[model samples]
Target: MASNPGPLTNWPWQKLGNVKYMVLSPFVANSLYSIMSKEERERDVTILYIYPFFLWRMLHSQLWISFARYQTSKTNHRIVVDKGIEFEQVDRERNWDDHIILSGIIGYIAVMYLPWAARMPMWRWDGLVLTILLHTGPVEFLYYWFHRALHHHFLYSRYHSHHHLSIVTEPITSVTHPFGEIIVYYMLFSIPILAMFCTGTASVSGIVGYITYIDFMNYMGHCNFELVPKWVFNNFPILKYFMYTPSFHSLHHTKFRTNYSLFMPLYDYIYGTMDMSSDKLYETSLKGRKETPDVVHLTHQTTLQSFYHLPPAIASLASKPYSPNWYMWMLWPIPYGFMFLTWVFGSTFTVERNVFDKLRMQTWVIPRFSFHYSSSRQKDAINGLIEKAILEAESEGVKVMSLGLLNQGEIFNGNGELYLQKHPKLKIRIVDGSSLAVAVILHSIPQEAKQVLLIGNLSKVSCAVSKDLCRRGIQVAVACKNDFYKLKLQLPTELCSNLIFSTSHTHKFWLVGDGGVQRDEAQRRALEGTHFIPCSQFPLAKARKDCIYYSTSAMIIPKALQNVYSCENWLPRRVMSAWRVAAIVHALEGWDAHECGDSMLDVEKVWLASLRHGFLPMVAP
Candidate 1:
């Protein structure tokens, strides 16, 4: 939204939410019905192509989004350096498809009511030429002045500022304008199509090609990377005036007072509105700089559908917590195809980047899933990937690298200690974040509670929590005799009195780190109002509505944490896993120690460091 909201700022079907796409159902149904009932000679070809074209436009824009995100995440050819895209920008750009709906509505009206549009041929060479000419002559000129008018203080605050909200642009950010502005842009863009209709030269191919050209230029101009090879302009200097590069438009976003042309810099040149720094910025962006992070969080894929939740996948989906959606089942083959690709060519890929004060951070994913770690045949490959990632981080001068999720599983990498054993002189400190995980788990227990049920396989974090609770004089009840024995062996003789074997699940607090099946069984046994605080990295499924389920060991990141648009797997927005935060805190405080394998850091010290560094405990709602 803009500062002073104006009329039609919101989309017409905005209230419809996800179901807004149903607005096109009438047109789609009618087009399909016509195709089925009438022969090819009798059916209107242009009308039949409308729905498919809309889908094509959507796919085209999404491809740009994925491509742009992938390029910006990489160190090469990035135009905007250091700046990160935030969630606010993702949400504002989510409705980029709104223009498709608007165009569909207008196309439906033209095909149904306009005689020339009702009977258009599929292709015409003259029509294509006319569209290019008209767009360059009239459309480009009009848009340049209109764009300048929009930047005026009055209209900028009321509408255009919303589009300008994303200074570090993405592909979709090009179309993320208020509805009122989009309506005017459609009017300006319709000149070529309407001209063709009036001149009796309109063709389906002409219409599709022109709109596609617009989308392509919009994406190319706004994507925050310099992709257009400099050789093109170097050889054909005249083309520099005819076309605008990504860096050319990036200057407009930064300086905000120049380079007002759309796709063409000819007008900006003619009107003397071009920025002087355009060519320099383009050259600098082409020779991209390398970005080395101070801290790295190493994570892995979880469920099959998690591929879609990656930052480079879908913006809206990635911004929210991951969940199994019924719709994802229909696209099941894609995930399998991705898995196959990972198997063939799997390596660490950068998932996200962030900045905290002067500390640069990044999250790199091992191209393996949870189930892959369980397979003995794939264990070596998974560890190899992890080892490769650690070495890569070390080579990049990363101060700290934290192992997240199953990457730190004892059976796999012995809580990330195997690498240290193999390479004892490694400078990059490998952190399992066990200390902070233990702190978060222990802090979650209510002060009034004297007894708590501890049900889970014996992991480093669980054992640490058990020992801490026992030392605090709280009864740590375990249902499994095997787990009880393990806890007794780990704890000191004085703390052994607090560890008791009990099958009772009536405890109000359950410290659960068990697998999904065992956790479900425990939920069934536990009484209503029980609080299930997870000590393990994995979160438990909520089996009972009456019982309260807290998130896995995590913390609400400080407001200063930048570029936290995507959720950390199942955790909510702005929430970081304790392990990830621990690594960050370790870097921030200049802690020169490794917390992995059987070794444990001071839980209290880690907890206080986190608080001092602005990571707050995630209080369960």
Candidate 2:
């Protein structure tokens, strides 16, 4: 949206939501029908090519998006410097495919209304040559001047500013524009195609080739990386006048007053609108710069669908917390294919990059899942991946690395302590975040409660919560006798009096941990209005409608946390796991000690420090 919105700014089918693709159903059905019913010679080849061409364009854009993200994550030829992309930009650009849909509709109309368009030849060299000539002479010139006029206050505020909102550009940023503005652009670009038709030189290949060239140049210029080698320009000096680099268009976004040419820089050079620092920025970006983080959070995929929920996979799905749906099962094969790829050829990769009060932070994912950690044979491989990530973080000068999800499982890596034993002199601190997880669970318990039931597996977090509650003079009843005896052994003589063994389901509050089938059975046994607060990393399934289910241990991040567009696993937007937040608090406070492997920090101290650092506790539903 722009500062001052104008009429016709919204796409006509904007309200259709996901079903907006239905607009193309008619054309697709007709094309398929034509192919099946008409004779080979009688069928309109151009019309039949519309749906497939649309699919190709989509795949082409997606490849650019994935490639650009992968390249920028590496320390090579990145044009943007340390700038983070925000949620607003992601939401605004979510509709980038609308232009392709518009083009499909226009093509369908042209084929039905124009006599020559329905019978265009398959190939024509003359049409391709004419398209190049017209685009360079008229399309490029008109677009340059039209672009300048859009920067004028009236049009800028109402429309063009929407595209400029993203200072750190991505490949899709090129097609992100107001519906009204894009319509005018379509008119200008149509000059070449319409002229070819008028001159009786139009062909199916010529039209398709022209559109593909536009997509390539648009993505290349806006990709925010200098991939055009200097050797190309040096060998052919005249190419500089006809071509523009990513750095050239990048300046137009940052400086906002120059480099207004289309794909060709000829107009900008002739009109004196090119930025003077374009060459310097190009050279500097080509050399690239490395980014070292202050904190690194180590996590892994939970379920197979989580692969698609990753930030780079799909922007809209990543922005929301993931939940299983019946429709998602339709795409089961995709996740299976990705799982096989990761098992065979995957290593640790960066999932997200963030900033907090000038502190650089990144989330690095280990290429494994929960089920892999459970397997006896896969344990060493999972541990190896974790150890490798820790060493890499240390090499990158990271101050703290926190383990999240099953990455810190006791049976797998002894809650991330195995790395410390292997590399005893490591500088980077290891944090399993048990102290903060305990804090969140303790704070969630009601002060008026006299007693609470502790059920499921007893882990470091559950034990810590039990000790804290007993110190507050609250009775902690253990549901399982084995878990009760194990927990009692860890407590001092004084706190043992507060611990009780019981199998009753009368308790209104239950602190649960990991148990698959048994956990669900316990929920059925609990009384109405019982509040089940999860002390584990994974959330619990709500089995009874009468009972209350709270989220797993997590906290709402401070407003100052930058670039938080994607959700962290099952956690909601801006809500981070306590384990991840613990490392961030540790780095901000400059804590030197490692908080893993049976070593526990002060529960109250860690909780207060988290509050002082602006991490708010999640309010219960």
Candidate 3:
């Protein structure tokens, strides 16, 4: 330790090559926020961690609630009540202090000295963006599934049902989960960390952005009144396929089994669990309509599922993969600690998620590396993971499952093929969802477009885009890497143009790309005055404001999820691959009601399908 001890010696290793990219890393930054050395930063980790969630909540929570109260006081929007249930004193009281304290306590433990889960904040814009992007997939998939899990007989009776206590909601209800439910939710946020570790680092702003996003969504969802202007959804109905409204969430609070989505309504729309009541409720709330909501208590077993089960707290622990880690020890004491903390802090604590029969639990860590990045041995690990997952599925007797994202590639490239060859007894059929997803992307296209500008690797889904448009006699302007002559040879001469950008008044343009020189060019051109359809998983930067941009991301959202915010990221996962499977399934099943299949896809068919399925129930996006 004494051999070369100094600032330089203590420094994190950095290559000359990497020095240029240090701004990309957390190691170097011109900003004052990153002035402290990392080791010293680690010492301050608890504070760093606390600020984003706990401290931020301290600053903003009361403000939102106060704002809600102020707004409500100013109008009938606050006093109008849901007829489904009467507001109780406990609801307001619980939100005012109980949830806040509980969140603080939980945040303290998670971001504190917990070696396994700690991630300090940083200010890099890229890190923040990467972190936000990384968490999108896992949160949507895991939360949607786990959320459904909470609605199961065992989980709902003891815990998740606690969240449903609000038939009519207020902003405070956003964080008003029981201890058990909150615990699971924190686990969901950790997905970004897992992603960060795999991608080599995390971003402070990214986590902050994600939290801000989810909490804002949570608050918006719980806010009793729908604040969206009816004219916006009516004038630009295409925007409705972007996300949930306060009324959409309010309906879920009352209906219980419907609207079980976390980030976007994609999962619900694809899975067909979207409650038809959402739009009407949203309109009712926005119009300042209110009625008493039915306060009928719904147990998961009785109201949703028929299976009798253990209490959720018990089920959560018993089902957890065995771990004798510090999380468990720290977790078991949380209940007692929570009470003590509440008593000491003088904040009231509710006994909602405290199921006595249950034990403390922790989510098993699953790294996102195999899915996000490729590696030497990661190939084997992915195969093994897939095999294990299949075995788990087989144990559960699930007959069919989709191999999503990276796993779909595992079917052909890695040991995934060997498993299929050797494990003949593993009768579960594995389906790749991208083909159907391509169909869905095709389906999301607008019918009125006479021409399409296709970007990115004009292969796979992009190729499908070319084919789809070409089949419909739509001119295709493709921007990709292949030699234009060679690509021209592969495609019909009449269908494509090497000049990727068109100055001519093309009726419509479609843009899609992954990171490359082509993507940059496409993005640049996209900023031009073209009515470009965004068909990527991520939102394009600096898109045109005046013209409409329909995204494949739109397919995941129901037309009812009215977007109230002006920040025009209508489809959040437009940059990430979150809902391709749902869109694929919906497209194949004619869930959008236009005839589509694996053999071929056409833009016109999809555009017509959009009309048929009411994909663009409104006018513009």
Q: For residues 1-621, what per-residue lDDT tens digits would candidate 1 score against the true structure? A: 898988989998999988999999998888778778998788777787888888899889988987888777765788864567888888888898889888888888789778988888889998988998999999999999999999999999999999888889989889999899998999999999999998989988889999999999999999999988989988999999899999999998888999999999999999999999999999999888898999999999998889889998888999999998888888799879978887788788887878898888988888888888889998888889999999989998999999999999988889988999998999999999999999998888879889988887778998888888899999999878999998898888988999999988788988887564354665787888998888888888889898788888999999888977899999889999999999999999898889898998999999999999899998765
Ranking by lDDT: 1, 2, 3
lDDT tens digits by residue: candidate 2, 1-621: 988989889999999998898999887787678778989888777777777888899989877876776666553687864566777788899999999999998888788678979888889999988999999999999999999999999999999999999988889999999999999999999999999999999998999999999999999999888899999899999888899999999999998999999999999899999899988998899877887999999999888778767776666778889887566787799778877887887588886778898788988888776777789998888888889889989998999999999989887788888999999999999999999999999889887788999988888999889988988889999988998988888888998999999989899999888874245676888889998888889888888899888899999999889877789988988999999999999999999999999998998889999999999999987
- Global lDDT of each candidate: 0.88, 0.88, 0.46
Model 1 misplacement above 4 A: 81-83, 516-519
Over the stretch 322-437, how does candidate 3's per-residue lDDT look in tens digits? Answer: 22344345345543453345335532111111000111101111123222234655566545555665565556454443443344442234313455555656645444334444
Better of 1 and 3 by TM-score: 1
RMSD in order of candidates: 1.6, 1.9, 23.8
Best by TM-score: 1
Backbone clashes (count) for model 1: 0
What TM-score number comes out for model 1? 0.97
**Native-vs-model 3 lDDT?**
0.46
Per-residue error at 592 for model 1, in Å? 2.1
Give the higher-lDDT candidate: 2 or 3: 2
Please state the error at residue 550 of candidate 2 in Å: 1.4
